[model samples]
Target: MASVEKVGNIEPMPKIYPIGGGKGGVGKSFVAASLGALLARHGRTVALIDLDLGASNLHTFLGMPAPKDGLNRFLNKHAQTLDSTAAPTPVTNLFLISSSTCSMEIANLFYAQKIKLINAIKKLPFDYVLIDLGAGTNFNTLDFFLTSNKGVFVCTPEPTSIENTFRFIKAVYLRKIKQLIKRHDFDAQAKAAVLDTASNALTSRDIMDIVATYDPEKERFFKACIGRFQFKLILNQFRKNADAGLGKKIETVCNRHFYSPFEFLGGVAFDERVIDSIYAKKLYVKNYPATASTMELEQIAELLANGQPASSLLQPAL
Candidate 1:
């Protein structure tokens, strides 16, 4: 990947993982922070970016009493480059680019600002860059989530969380479709047919059928674009073996319902110490090494570090 200095000038994009769940209190910032600590422990240089906008608190999770500088500096032109805004954390080889200064208005970035931020993030000089996205499927949240080399979705067993998780995935997929077709014209009839949100043209199959009806050749290529959307899922707040199976169930539903690759990378059991660590101002992975959640997160981090495929996530770990 390119150094943060040369991001906009033909530098390679870093391996970025944007973590988000559709709802708040779903453990996205926690997962992002813990994963960043674990990756640093594994000897990889990692950056945890808080893109939660107005509700940003990832710095607190990382034990940052006060992040004096961050993304806002770059956005406001106080910092010339994105790298300069990254603040050091207690963990070695791990840094943080917080959104603590962002307000509700900052969440809605201008198109030019969005492009600049994305370019800088893509070229950060780190082995891994994990973005903690905000709750709900807003355009900013979805756009950041889509910027990842591998998007990571965090959800608990709660029915609402599960449903929203699916909604978030579908939103991202459909957004990609819209992005692809926005630049290239299909047929006027096909455009009007699918773009009509009131209709039942919701599924990938439905859209493909509409496109195929208009032009068979374009349908094949558009289907390929849809097939490229891939992401990893982590089930959090798991309390029992039944809850463990929720990950598998969600994966199955997504595989059957969506066109892209979705994998469940094991679940983090509910551990009281996680909260205790949070209150103690220490990273859970750093303070509670023996906790079940910490161990499971380490396994997930190992798999991610090793470049394990989505198919491999089906197997149990650690």
Candidate 2:
């Protein structure tokens, strides 16, 4: 667990990545744990926050009993800071702040409480912080996901999961546009791109067209906000020949439909050992080093930790 420290001595803000699924039982937690374990194994200080909130169960992936102290303490005033509640996990250099112990009402966080937690999350001292979010495209989930330096969407190859994940991505994009519009002093053209309800989001003119609609000087300004988002995708439980190629397919769909800077990071293959590791209450990457899943997870973590430029990650000609 990371001990509380004063802000003056801390380094740069750590890379924050929030992982969420369109629905449950798609192995979002499994993929999250594997990434955390891999990052920790590589000697990065990692914090895995189980923001599945009141129903938190990420501790199970780390092979631990339910956390007795965490977000609840900070929220209920038992602790002064959220970072102080990070509980040490079995993995070296990795800590978890599970909130399964929180009361049911904690799931419905007030705006003030959510802001407080978000501010605290940014201040936590670590190389990487991966938030495991609850299922849904609700305000809480999208807010947390957007707070990440890079938003990660995890979904199975199933059509339902893929469609819902698309919905979640679109929801987050709308939220992102709203935030950028509020924060930046956008001119009329830029404002219309975001505020216009009739704009075809997936077809016709996308964000680039909106930026070009502005005056030449203002075009750069609008592009800086509309064209600069980094979101990563992971396809899990991949089982067939087509499944292996779904990464590029998703990238194409995102480009054509949402004008999104979504990068298909990689895919995780279906493996029996994953279930075995889960049943044994251990992270598959840490416990089954020789497995194909572990190898794929290691590669994905490496790519994520390397942190490519948003434009480079996205498909060309977008």
> Which candidate has the top score in lDDT?
1
Model 1 clash number: 0
**Full-model lDDT for every candidate:** 0.81, 0.77
Q: What is the lDDT of residue 156 in candidate 1?
A: 89
Q: Write model 2 residue lDDT over 52-148, tens digit each, in one string.
A: 8767889888888887889899988899988889999989998998888888888889888887788789878888999999898778888788666
Query: Which lDDT tens digits does candidate 1 get at residues 96-163?
Result: 99888765688778877877898788878899999999999887787788775379999988889988
What is the Cα-based TM-score of model 2? 0.82
> Which residue window of length 10 is worst by lDDT in model 2?
1-10
TM-score of each: 0.88, 0.82
